[model samples]
Target chain A: MAKLSRRRFLTETSAAIATAPFISTSATRARAQESRKLGFAICGLGRLSESQIAPALARTRHCRLAGLVTGTPAKAEAYMAKYGVPAGSVYSYDTMHRMADDPGIDVVYVATPNALHAEHATRAAAAGKHVFCEKPLEVSVERCRQMIDACKDAGRLLGTAYRCQYDPHHLECIRLVREQVFGAPFIIEAGFGIDVGGPDQWRLKRDLAGGGALMDVGIYALQATRYLTGEEPVVVSALETKTDPAKFAEVDESMVWTTRFPGGVVAHCSTSYKAGGIQNMRVNAERGWFELDPAFFYNGNHGRRSDGQEIRFPEIDLFAAEMDDFAQCILEGRPSKVPGEEGLRDVRIMQAIYESARTGAAVPLA
Target chain B: MAKLSRRRFLTETSAAIATAPFISTSATRARAQESRKLGFAICGLGRLSESQIAPALARTRHCRLAGLVTGTPAKAEAYMAKYGVPAGSVYSYDTMHRMADDPGIDVVYVATPNALHAEHATRAAAAGKHVFCEKPLEVSVERCRQMIDACKDAGRLLGTAYRCQYDPHHLECIRLVREQVFGAPFIIEAGFGIDVGGPDQWRLKRDLAGGGALMDVGIYALQATRYLTGEEPVVVSALETKTDPAKFAEVDESMVWTTRFPGGVVAHCSTSYKAGGIQNMRVNAERGWFELDPAFFYNGNHGRRSDGQEIRFPEIDLFAAEMDDFAQCILEGRPSKVPGEEGLRDVRIMQAIYESARTGAAVPLA
Candidate 1:
């Protein structure tokens, strides 16, 4: 036919655009032929980056450390040299969005402190990139929701670094709960605690770390309680402790809390910064009790249970499986095992726990 | 002496008795170089007594099985034959009181159903013997208090069997919690559950066993939580379930409950009969966490950590220690390790749990 009227032409073009596929790097790229050579980038290279995350990333398979981002050029160069990172992939915080322009960078793992996660994640999403955010998902439920929204708006996926979810021992505990091996689970007992003495540590600052160990480690148990019981907490009651006025001036040193579910399941949990480093989770069911003696983070020794058999994970790296999971989520367009909403829910519970602790009453989660 | 008025003679006799030095049993009786041969009598030798108490006594020192009292004469005879008990010591319920006249029996172990414990223990006390009663001293707090009163009236000691309190794993867990190794505890998670195939057992009878698994097993965890925390619970909230109305006709099959203590520590606990066997407890403190993976009533396996060293109680005789403690309490005229009032408080808490479970509201213990 001849040239159409202006309105008809505009309507036809809009319809064509709506029907066509939208392109994103994760969706458009071919799967790397070398299954063991996947590429990934490090966002917010902080202490964890230097101590555990970067080192673990170097040792992981199905993925390799490919790029770095930091405001400090010297630190970036050092990180690149330590991990054999490529030169063109280095990015400043201001120019991190340009990382999307590099085809070699497949995923952006955000290991920054609590407050910076949203900004980095939003920028990465705007660049049409997948994101692996660290814990607390930007310090608040609202921020977590916004990050999720941003990822959805950019047609990308988001994953949170709750490394415990990838832990085999934790997985077995979850299985026992879900399969009713212990019978209808009636209670979950869990906690995370450490003697983090340094006053200058980022975790001691509410603005940078969100709250306390509750935000950092207790969330592991909270998320685990939900995953294990397969029930959402309906009400929460809690208590807070801050022994040293000056050292833990900004955040709580310890927190004890309880969550009640509709199906009569209760989770009793606690987190502390003024205590010795120990992590554990136990579920009591109708049939029998199943437990992981020591849970959460440990390096020298670890244990898991599979089909009633206790399996030890000696000298295992938690960061490897966590990093691999993030890459797979990016490559497959699949949802993360611990998704953005899981992080949001955890933050919501954390907020409720604080509110309850402050008010000396039980706070209901609506 | 000159004939005196009846009232004066009675008063003089009382004065003479009171003025006389308190008799040391050793002075009136012959002393043996070996340890005193303590003899114990078990009443209502059913499941717990047969499976745990009797076998445990066999493995013990400082005590030996001297007699058995059963409602069924056949059971009494059978048990005596199997345990190599003396022929003069077997008695039925009706004759149990007279069996206390037997000189060989120094203590009575009340392992009867909940409802019978009060009567059996009271009679044992009246016969001038020490009493070791199984958990939930009586069906009700009023009855438990009565048992305490009777034992005191008779000048005899009353001890409730809280086996886990003597277990090495649990003892270490308690030490860490009380020492604040995990920090000032803010939350407690305690639970006990077992899958009992609806065997029409006495425990399912409201009149005989008092309540459900809560009265039988959950009380152990509740007592453990309180003993470990050394704090009284001020408020209680609970939910109860019985999926199979026929099986759990007069009792609850499952329960989820909570307790709030003075320092804002909250214990969220559960108990169930339709689940597999599980025994676990956790304390979350301001500084750290203390937990027992295989917490209560384990046959052999147990583990804990204290003072930076892992303590694994591969195998130990908990019952022997429990019996020995009772014996020492009696022989030394010291208070029981877990005295009658402690049992009374646990019963009070249990009653509150049931009431809260029924009312769907928080019941204040205070």
Candidate 2:
């Protein structure tokens, strides 16, 4: 992640040097050139922020932790103490509009819960900072569009953090398929399942988490299917099963769905909150098959071909890579590879899956 | 296959002796007691008959090859040369009715092309012999029912040769699932695919073969799902893809289907004629997972559980076991475990699968 960004940084730096002939104050120019890396404010310091994103900011070459946004003063104090953020840089979610006056933060990474992604993202955009949000962008398609439209109205870039899009193993698998190394991939079987916590967890609430396992981990499989084939599913048929009905009354416990893409490719995908160690993605092609056992993980992953060739690549910090890539997109004034539209696409597909499961029928996408 | 049969053979032989006091003529009783093994007439001298079933008959303890029914004199001569059979016992497809006069042949094994199974099975049943038909039963559900009805009308046992039902590896896997060794299995992923022959082969012809991969090989995956779960699918959604339209104009080259069972269990299945060695069956339960790699093969199969235990079983002639079981069922005046009803179930499912593929929608079964 750093290698390519550094090369681009040097090239852009030389370009900036060649155009530094304006007669402005030397001090102002010095401040302008102080840090080439983008500064990010983390919105919502929950488990993801505490475990992955905050640590990742320290490792990214093109980004740094510059601010914190939360309603809790204790979380703000701990984040400030550990990451060395100034007292003035920490603000509550209600006072986030004051960040428009602070030039330190160039982007806001929304690590809030699923339902709050739209609110945080739009608030960040209104504060004149670019927004980088987590997966399942929001619980509903309408909310996802609101986040996108807010950024568009505020003239700020909006990126959805699809972590696997930046992972080397995933990239390698996508490359092999796009290169026709395994022929045109016609069938893909991808699933992610992990036994979740007790019923009191926020993930068990339909209003908060959207739809349990399908929203949390299953979307990873859904996203992988889309990126792996570079195609959108035209139709989907799904089945939702629950081992415990009372525990999963508000959400799906297990879901299995099959879909057909526009170009003859079909996928069988599954997800669950009742089974563990069921994470894997397999692609069957014209020649043979290739798969990633434990395909989606924050720790590490392994991918290999049917003929026994490992999809070997260095395991860099995936969190750092995605953040830096989004930062790089902000720096270059370019739309991110996974923009808000991409996130909205997944939300729409997921809604269709839920609809199919609920209706006990196949759902067609327009 | 022989070990269990030997035990049963001994038990049945003792029972026969216990009832021998009512014998009227010693010559008639001696003839009845001469051979406990059922004599089989192989109805078609095809590749499966020549390679697996004929050789398997040599290994079975309760069955023997007593007749050859075929129009090809050369195949008959070669089979006769290898396995001893009298010239008078050899008959063509049209003259197979003459076998009613000979009591030596007790069962007719139908190993013809997919389309001819109904005619041969019904004829064999009318000839006063039990019918042991090969996989697929027939191309259409109507024809399959005809075979079943004809056998019922004649009071002759009709059994479908589902070899995997007798395969030790598959049986072991089924046993593990049934015993809840991996917890109650709620999801199964099963597929069988082989790069079939060119366009000249009967498998590519719509008339002789019902479908390409789905019939020739894919049915194994479909049947495995049924046996592993012991539940009939309630509905089926399917997709069929062909890499070469002209070559597969008459049949399906590749097919992927997803189905839901009555008890919330779902299956994702695929079959192909353009991809080789894509055969495997994996079942995911509440606790963990278990799988059979290369699950459907005439050669061998390996099944392993996720908790690091082996579902190990001794490799035996699956063909021999299925034949012996059918013969034993005849001797005991009972139905074979995999009787006409079981075969009809698979045929109905596959027909639903094909219908769903053709209509590009889900087909619900009654």
Candidate 3:
């Protein structure tokens, strides 16, 4: 998968958010509107929201960019004008729930940094809005479960932006491994790391990004491990390394961890911001192997079987698929490919990696 | 690249031993005129030696079958007859050095259990014979270094069979990363793991296999990180895991390790014989990513740029290249591509992994 460039990422995320649907008390009309065209209101219009999410929404066919929610009035007005959003579509974070009163907006896509996800998503769920948020789910597992529970209580859907699960190459890998072409896979190795500039970035802030690249990109690998193996990790061990205490004052620069399942399979993963850019995953079995690379990025991918044949999949827009799937779920009243529990499980594992990294030992997740 | 069957491995090993020149002195013009073929004398015809090594040798062209070294006289006699070896070529471990007295042999390939490599190779080196040994080099880094120095002093070459380094796909990945195609990589993820059979195997005996799969297959990933990046890891942190104490009596069943180089490049590697098999290596750099799949296995491989174009290379026999390189090093008086010091460095790092795994914190390597 190609790494979504900052500009493209924002554009894609925006597009996805704009087309997503909101929850309605009346199922019949809501489902009709949802199937026709889902409208999304984005909660944050910062770099990620403006550059990727908005553009993604604008480019989406199943959804439309309905509204903007920003504390900054100027940004809200400017973003609405740039995307041709109507004047009634603008709302501040304090008044975001009022969007429920507007028929234009169907879903609330929270694209803020890690810490804001829980509050924004929970409030969106309360207002009877469908929720789609970026990764880490929440800074804590408890908070993530809370989001899930709130969404359940409100009868609104909850989904995470685990794009890799929708990625064609990754899906193919999962398919092959599931088929046992490799013969009882015993190990899964996954990792993602990048040189994410200075401490000025929101990711460097523990309060904002939760944990580092592991939260940002590494979680994809962890999620991939689970999806590929179809097993839950029962135990975990980890090691964390940081070069400069000042640079990595709160979050880690890099980490290596292992997750053990009830079966003999172990998933090993590594993540680093200190390293330039890295993303990859490998699955090895008795008879053969399956792998994906540039595993974690948003671009094209390379994959093959242990028998030396390329695994080909008809290319589809991953972001589009994710958006369409969510829309379809809402239209059909079904569950999502990456539902709340999937998000909860990944967050749980991410937290375990942090715990293991902190204690510098094997942490049993039991 | 074919996985060598025991018969082929031993036949080639014996061939490499039998048809060769002396370590200290070349054969006379008349003797050299007979044939410039490589011959091997294998000391232990155990399963691994028989299955992988012998089959690999039979497939090799640079060497021809020469002799067998076994404690079982009947077995040795049977193998010689089966492979069409002459009667005088068979010898037991105690009489292996005396094979140097024969003009037909040139190298002594040590496929014995781990703890015996030092004594066996030391004797072979002292006997003025080139030595080909399996990994772990020896039980200790000090012993590994001693093996290196002894071979140097005796004017005999020492080569460790790090087969992955000879793989075309792996070499291409290393080349791309080192050339900065990925642009000064920051994080490296690599690992080897497989489900081991009954716990009573020699690998469970610390004195025999030296360590578990970390010393066996995991070392491939370690050497891979070093060769691919062309950097020495400066500091280390790691964690080890085992399922049952009784079953994991001698060595650990699983490990997760990290090596931090001076420039903030961290190589994270995990190894396990008790886990599912998942072997792979990935280098994440600023510009892009490069990865290898089925990393250590002979056949399965896929290498590519982050954009997913298959990085192409001329197909060549990896084992043949390894054997041929050793032959050239011996013929042209060049150093081995995978030399003793490289073996020693990995062992040093392995020791640090064990330390960190034990102490539950980062351990620095000097």
DockQ of candidates 1 onward, in order?
A: 0.25, 0.54, 0.19
When candidate 1 is compared with the true two-chain complex, its DockQ is 0.25
The reply for model 2, stretches above 4 Å from the true place, is A1-35, B1-35
Query: How do the residues A1-366 of candidate 1 rate in per-residue lDDT, one tens digit apiece?
Result: 232243234333322322234342553423322232445678887788888888888667656677788888788888767665767889888998897676556567888888788888888888766678888887888888889999889877788888877777776677777677745766667777777767877888888887877887777778878888777898887766665658878887777777778776777776777765446676766545666656776453344432366645545577888888776655444678888887888888889988977876678897
RMSD of 3: 8.7
Q: Single out the weakest 10-residue window by summed lDDT for candidate 3 chain A.
A: A1-10
Per-residue CA lDDT of model 3 for A106-147, tens digit only, reads 678888888988889888887767888888788888889889
Choose 2 or 3, whichever is better by lDDT: 2
Residue-level lDDT tens digits of model 1 in B1-366? 232243234333332322223233553223321335456889887877787788878777556677788877777776766766766778777777785457667678999989899999988887766789988899898899889998888777889998787887777777787677666666677777777655667988999989888998888789877988788988877767665668888887877777777865667777877764456676666544556656776455355444445557667777888997776555444577798888889989999989877765567778
- Binned by DockQ into CAPRI classes (incorrect, acceptable, medium, high), candidate 2 is medium
Candidate 1 chain A worst ten-residue window by lDDT: A27-36
Ranking by TM-score: 2, 1, 3
Best by lDDT: 2
The alpha-carbon lDDT assigned to residue B128 of candidate 2 equals: 79
DockQ, model 3, C-alpha based: 0.19
Who is ahead in TM-score, 2 or 3?
Answer: 2
- TM-score-wise, the better of 1 and 2 is 2
Report the Cα RMSD per candidate.
Answer: 9.3, 5.8, 8.7
